[model samples]
Target chain A: MTMKRLINDPYDVVEEMVEGYVKAHDRYVKMCDLEEAQGRVVVAKDAGTKDKVGVVIGGGSGHEPLFIGYVGENFADGVVIGNINTSPSPDPCYAAAKAVDNGKGVIYLYGNYAGDVMNFDMGAEKADEEDDIRVETVLVTDDVVSSENIPDRRGIAGDFFVFKAAGAKAAMGADLDAVVAAASKCNDNTRSMGVAMSSATLPSKGGPIFDMEDGDMEIGMGIHGEPGVRRGKIEPADAVIDEIMDPILKDLPYEAGDEVYVLVNSLGATPVLDLHICYRRVAQILEEKGIKVHRALVGPFACSMDMAGMSVTLCKLDDELKELLDYPCDTPYFTQVK
Target chain B: MTMKRLINDPYDVVEEMVEGYVKAHDRYVKMCDLEEAQGRVVVAKDAGTKDKVGVVIGGGSGHEPLFIGYVGENFADGVVIGNINTSPSPDPCYAAAKAVDNGKGVIYLYGNYAGDVMNFDMGAEKADEEDDIRVETVLVTDDVVSSENIPDRRGIAGDFFVFKAAGAKAAMGADLDAVVAAASKCNDNTRSMGVAMSSATLPSKGGPIFDMEDGDMEIGMGIHGEPGVRRGKIEPADAVIDEIMDPILKDLPYEAGDEVYVLVNSLGATPVLDLHICYRRVAQILEEKGIKVHRALVGPFACSMDMAGMSVTLCKLDDELKELLDYPCDTPYFTQVK
Candidate 1:
């Protein structure tokens, strides 16, 4: 085992990460004080904004800045953090809804995972039965290679755009229903596919969760080391991007006149230099298709710890989607200024 | 050579990077029009902001978002990009000064390295002889382990704070002398130390820049895989922090009641979860010492492309430094709204 992690007590990685996260981003977030969710829930300080629906997001941990770091002003109102690559408990999910519930209600947003669906749904049930708070859900399904059925597709980096759109809609004084619609709209328009060069090291296990031959690459692999469409010797960046982008662009049926927001994300170990190199290809492809790029974000937004890989996400943009994505927000890992 | 980098034509990495950078961040930056510096210089779109002293920063290519990512509103006015782990040529450096020069002079800020000093000085002299633009410089020397003499020390992630201070000072309409002083003061108060568990891969070489056993870590290494003070088996995060913080705290003579702005930066491959875990220990240590943390930034601000390592930087704070550091600025990688 050759894990390179800066952590103590591998079992306590989650708790320590939360403590450190809240401390480092104290200006934007805080631990949930609610007894039921005490440590598991991280809430934005500006949550429960007047007349706005509560935007609660969560999933497994390890993909840092994803489920937790997005909780901030005009973004996620609260987040339920889980163990690395595992779903959160139902209690924390319920507690997240409780903590962020303004009079307008709450909307639960996350990727389409079986464990998450089972857990968050139960939490929503508890919220409805125990407290009369209305809780809605919008599962992000944007990974085109995951499934032929669009609803069964697993969310990947496109979760960023879906979350941002939902957050912005809620911040604009939308109700739970409207926020859910916005999340669904963004998820429908978003598509992501990734190539993993290596597997992420698991802290508690003290080794990589899976094995990936060093010189090989797996196209369309999920963040948690799930199987992708193909495994072969690594190819040049442009070729790999062309392979991945084809299905995404075709699946969305994105037309030449369409506009998009591009995100070239690093899966933990990939560097910004390489990410930009990949982005250059994505730009070229978009230009060739006559598709206009509204904005481009190149860096690690979602990641697998110590994993070497990259993902490309495209969020087809309309006037409303563009405004929602451009709305200002600030968090520990991401920030946008008006 | 089990390296996994996604780039094309290794020789063209720098040009492609600059092209991708300008395209992705068109809102904040533009390509320098000077034919001699055509693709080598990236200047802030708002450079030459009315009467404000120009803040020019640059170093090499691998450290993306450092020199170029910072060229934006109220930050670095211009950047001279170079090849990987190399310095920019004198012509581009001179062009950067001319491009960003408002009526006030340009201030060149970068890590203190022999190659960079020789090249930028030549550029400064050329600017003076040709364009009559007075360019002042303040080299950042914050890596505590580099040298015994302050000015002889190499710069590391601490470059972020020094450049930020200079940018803020310049944005506030400070004269070249005042901006230089601000950069000097920030550099004097800042200290950094890093650990490298593995070497960063070089694009051109298509392999690791150096080699080490998987579980071993070197303390106080520079970003370019430079040697450090100690090498041993990997230790717990807290233990590692203790080993690193002791020298930084003692070198700065940081005492009780001192306030500091802390930055726990990843050297590429390290994840945000690990960074926060490291920051927790830093906070604990400061608390034990009765030192107050004014603010903390935990992420990959400066990186050594896919290297498995992390660095901690602390800027001892005063009222002036605090105000300048907190001032709002926007760039592709970083943004402070308030």
Candidate 2:
């Protein structure tokens, strides 16, 4: 029997974890607008504070400390979450913005995806119409592969780069336009691509979300358990990095004069050793490309619950962008340079 | 063909991880003690004030934020770490005391095991004779499993509980003897027992140092990867809880009138889902026993580094014990209730 348990049916599991994660980490609660309804779980940094520039970012729940985890001082102002991969409803996003905004405005920044765009856009539009609170959004479409063919690229793991880059500028008294510009600049300079070995099993689905032979893994797997660009057999860390980084390096095509920030993200169960091995090769590869890596990070920045694989992100940077990129933020999943 | 590459040399993994864990969690580095060694790692926290009672705890390198991880304000005054399961060297312990001591003597409180006892004793003897700081030692002989008949009633996961209770007493400026008495009392009241699905992979060993079948799990496993009291096929969450809770409850033999503090600790790699599932059952089991669980914590409190198992600890409580138990602590691995 393919063993599995529906997480929703076991409502206690999510509730218990949310309560514990919050208690262990920090205080986070649903935005008043979405608290009554079951859609968005908007969380504010200072629930005690009346209003501020509501900075909201969220997605599916599993990649914890990601969407919800990172909402704290010098980080996100609020977070609005939905089921894993799905988008939160209009009410929650609107609720989150209103709760944090002190008539200044709200910035809804998240990965670019159809679902999130629909709901968050709806939320933003509704906020303007219903409450007259100005809401602006900067869709972070940073994925090299998905965005390559489409006019507007899809957002991937690199969204946090933008979130932090903009989050710091915003938290440090940047106005709504400047904050939006900073977030969009991050979106322009950033590109992320990932791969997976062994499909991840969602809490609701006991079986692997997709099938891959023991000897094979898929490249370009989506963070939401979506299919990847292609499949390949087991390979050495160097060889795998070649597969992941070459496409990224080529697509972004950093010139010899360019400087970039590198992030090696794990998709859940890919061991840290593998992350290091991959990064070790990446350092060499970038050096070979004669591209100066100003800074790099290797960790489970964006994960697919228990998925086993890794991703690489490169953010093209200049002097102005570099300082903002180096800005500090403390989120549950991602901690920026401190 | 289990293929892997070390994040560092297999030899340096433990020490490197420790260094990394400490840097990431620097808040635990205490008031001052940074200059102990010319190029030495910062001795996290020192024994309160030398004049006040000092509580020192130590053990292996891996389990981050544990023995070493818990040494900070509201926590252990200092930590003496061993290489893996090996106890801390006498030199470090002696140095740690001298660094932390103000005028009063230091008290060495650690798990009861031959290695820890011998080394800690040596350090204590040397510190008392040489340094102006007085040094005393107390052994936590809690495990109901290990008995005199079994060569030693060894200390194990239950050390943290006893430490917290004792550390709180010491923090209140208790005298050395009083701190030792309080710590000893906590140890006597506390008991822990765990089950492991597999043995931990020693850094030197490329593979797991011990073995269990694919579907088999052992009951009553120790955090040190020591053989458990029993081994068996996988059990349901309820069955797992029953096996774990029965021994802990039986060992302590709690009375209907007794109130208690409970902890559900993940060895490592066990998801929060499993932790919460186990915690839920643990709370249920305690309720059925008519034992009031006054305080509860469920997380990777005391882990065995990537070992997939959990241990349950219960400290039968009274008013005095409860007050100490409720004291606040900020350590890498634990944040206690105020």
Fnat of every candidate, listed in order? 0.69, 0.06
Q: What CAPRI class is candidate 2? A: incorrect
What tens digits encode model 2's per-residue C-alpha lDDT throughout A1-338? 12222123333455555544544343334334445335445465573264346687876566644676567766687778676556877777777776777777888898878888898898888789988988889888776777456337777778768888877777777778888988888888888888776566655664566666765777787777666688877566667778778778777657887898888776655544346556666777887888887776655566665566778899999886787877765544444433
Least lDDT summed over 10 consecutive residues: which range in candidate 1 chain B?
B43-52
Per-residue CA lDDT of candidate 1, range A1-338, in tens?
48988889999999999999998889989899888785999998866656789999999999986878898888898999889999999999999998898789999999999999999999999999999889999999888899999998898889899999999999999877888899999998999999999899999889989988879999999999989999998888889999999999988777788999999999999989988889988999999999999999999888888889999999999999999999998877778985
Question: Pick by lDDT: which candidate is best?
Answer: 1
Q: Against the true structure, whose DockQ is highest?
A: 1
Best by TM-score: 1
Q: Which sections of candidate 1 miss by over 4 Å?
A: none
Docking class for candidate 1: medium
Task: Give fnat (model 1).
Answer: 0.69
Tens-place lDDT per residue, model 2, B189-271, is 88877777756656577567676675568787667876667777766666787877876777756777689887776665454
Residue B142, model 2, lDDT: 60
